[model samples]
Target: MIRPKWTPVAWLADRMAVLVLGLIAGFLVGLSFAGDGRILPAATTVASTDGPAPSPVPPAPPVAAQGVDGPIPPQVTARMRRGGVLRVGVFGDSFGNGIWDALYRQLPTSDGYEVLKFAKEATGFTRYRTLDLEKRAYEQLARDPVDAVVISFGANDAQAVYDDGHLYPLMGDGWKRVIGQRVDRFVAAARSTGAVVYWVGLPVIRDPQLDADMQAMDGFYEAHMRRLGVPFVDSRPLTLGADGKYTAYLPDSKTGRPVLMRTGDGLHMIGIGYQRLTSGVAADLRRYAARVRQAAGRPAPTPTGEPR
Candidate 1:
């Protein structure tokens, strides 16, 4: 049909207008989803919330073993293997002091147990010199629970006089009695902590008479330790050579010759002496553990000479 030209143009314009509107609508819908080309679909977008995040699980607390009066029983081996720290408090004079630094260097860094040392120089058991030493030692024990304690105070106490009208050498008989009582108090202090206590008796000296005094002190210490069921490590024999004399600074066991075991004063041992003393003590500690196990009616753990 031959239609009017203006009518055809108007119809074409109307169709173009509808097409433009449809394109505009499509662009708006696309903008809503894509968000200015920086966003993904609205369905995939997430919004912030006001609630707390999920909490993380915490680790369980350490298990504390029950009180052990004497030795570690056999049944507790599994528990000990689970591994806890071993804090140590050393009470003694120069001799003990040497061992402390040596052990501090020798103890394995990767070992399961941890060792702590508290010491005072030239300190003794008796109140003759200072009660400060005793007070400090007690404070250390109270601060932490230790598995073992080592005592090396007799060297200073061999000539110790009590404040109770007793003196050393000059007061002879009464002096010994008072000194013994003071030692007892010292041992009692450590005993109350439930730690396996090891008393390192004084070593042999160059003077024969000093050796005699040390012997008497050793006897008294051993008796008290046995009475209290504590371990006594008599290092005098280890320090002496086969010649029955205080071995040279670092006496060679096989040759009976002096090695480098002392400082310039020829009285105190150097690092090597400390090494020997600690190794011996470490061995004895293992033995003590075994004895404790047996006493506790459990299978004794094997004794090791090396540090754990």
Candidate 2:
């Protein structure tokens, strides 16, 4: 058999062709292993919205299971059994001032109840950058512990809020969620000290628009407090008449004659108004105290005929 002699250039070219083939085979094997023998299409690019998508609203934390069913803590019952002075902390905006004053004057002193007021006028949780109510309440709790806390706000919260340089209008869902989270934080802070929280809702305001806003805010407060197993007091019905209208005067308990319940500003309450407004709140506190005492197996004190 006769064979043609190969040139060095031809041999080199043949070797290069073999090397190229080997490289192609190796690449195909690697690709098959990477994709598990399945073919994938190229990824498609999607155009985003005009601006950054709004952040997903965070879900509120699950309600604490401890007190949801309304059982008083043993620590609270033990304190009640000690028969020492019971300290109540009143904290919030100016609306709280009248409530605290009325509670201090009317809460049964014979039962060893003392009220400590810590309200700031024209401040709320919405303007947290300016004044954080949760931080303030936490600081106060650290300074002096109280058996219970009374909170009333929203008077100054119905306004625009500047968050991260974005202005959110009042009474919007986003605004309400932010405010609700703040309330949750404050209530949690107060509860951390083993103190019961009583959130008082705002009453009807004179301005129809402001009144509607306040009513909406009250819904937020009530929902949060209920979920947290805290007591919520709605003062609107107390200030409103049977026709669901805001009244400056209602029949006084002492006298059947009409007595002024609201101040000229329509947002504030006069002394007599506060006196009447706080009566129901005082009753709730008394009932709570009684429950604590009863839970501790201690008999509640006999009535001294004190006018709540």
Using lDDT, give the best candidate's number.
2
Model 1 Cα lDDT, one tens digit per residue, 153-253: 66555453544332334124445455555665666566456666666666666656546766787777676666555556666666666566776555553
lDDT of 2 by residue, 60-136 (tens): 76675433236676667677777655567888776777767777767657776768888776577767887888888
Report lDDT (CA) for all predictions: 0.52, 0.66
Off by over 4 Å in 2: 1-54, 61-69, 81-83, 291-304
Clashing pairs in 2: none
Query: For model 1, what is the error of residue 12's alpha carbon versus the real structure, in angstroms, after optimal superposition?
Result: 99
As a whole number from 0 to 100, the lDDT of residue 93 in candidate 1 is 64
Top TM-score prediction, candidate number? 2
